[model samples]
Target: MGPDDAFWEDGEWVSWDEIHQQIQYKEWRAKWPNADLSLVPVFEDLISVAEDYFLATGRHLQVYGDIGELYAAITYGIRLHKNFAQGSDGRLGNDHIEVKTIAPMNTKDQTSVKLSGHFNKLLVVNISEEFEISSRMIDRASLPKTSGNILKIRWDDLA
Candidate 1:
């Protein structure tokens, strides 16, 4: 195998979303034939600007949550509900899904999300310090019962 193949097989990945601006509308159409990807440019621009600002100032913009939601929708073929929709974020087939994103700048290392709404399944996403994104999906029934609504999805969940 080549060096690039070895790099990928070793469980390291580079973010392909870095080429967001380079894709054509037709390419997006081919990628998601059932979904409209017209807003890709806007999302790409927002991410680019945020990353640039963070690099220059070393402070994260409060945009990672939104990024995570968008990433989930596109990556997992979920149809999103309108913003501020109570209960859950979107639908995947017949399942109501909620998404939680862990930011790269979270120094505490521990992260938990408050599940205040109704969802059949949960998608926990994390952006590593290196900016590689990963996710874990859990059935609502599999999650541990907590007194509060908090779901403590540790970093190892992504591993």
Candidate 2:
């Protein structure tokens, strides 16, 4: 697992919430100046697409980094337990939802770790633009049985 990746099963949730509440783009960019925002529009666009897909298909959608530790933390946030099953439209209707981030490892980088764990009913989604390294990677996994309307996003449509 990468330093950024965390295992929620044994990690604290407050840290995740803390980062979520505190981290912003401006502040984030101050830390990593070379960061690119070209993908910002793409991120927004993909989010809307995922939202629409979820609404139309009632599927559970999540965004994550390619690192396993990061995604594990996300899955932990969703409270994934053993023997979890897929809900309607390939979603987990339980208190926690199943979403993940699967990024391809760089073949040139021999030290890269694999984040793709075997999920019998896992639903993974990727939302990143080519060659754009995002700094504010977040995992927004939902809790099980959280009754609410299907996602309805508002964003710019390149489509």
Q: lDDT for each of the candidates? A: 0.74, 0.35
List model 1 lDDT by residue over 84-149, tens digit each: 999988999999999888888977544676677889898887877766677788888877788887
Which portions of model 2 miss their true places by more than 4 Å?
1-34, 60-159
**Residue pairs with backbone atoms closer than 3 Å in model 1 (clashes):** none
Worst 10 residues of 2 by lDDT: 150-159
TM-score leader: 1
Give the per-residue lDDT of model 2 (tens digit) for 107-159.
22112111232222333433333323222222233212224533221111101
Q: Evaluate residue 62 in candidate 1 and report its C-alpha lDDT on the 0 to 100 scale.
A: 92
Prediction 2 global C-alpha lDDT:
0.35
Models 1 onward score TM values of 0.72, 0.23
Model 1, runs deviating above 4 Å: 1-35
Q: Candidate 1: TM-score?
A: 0.72
* TM-score of candidate 2 to 2 decimals: 0.23
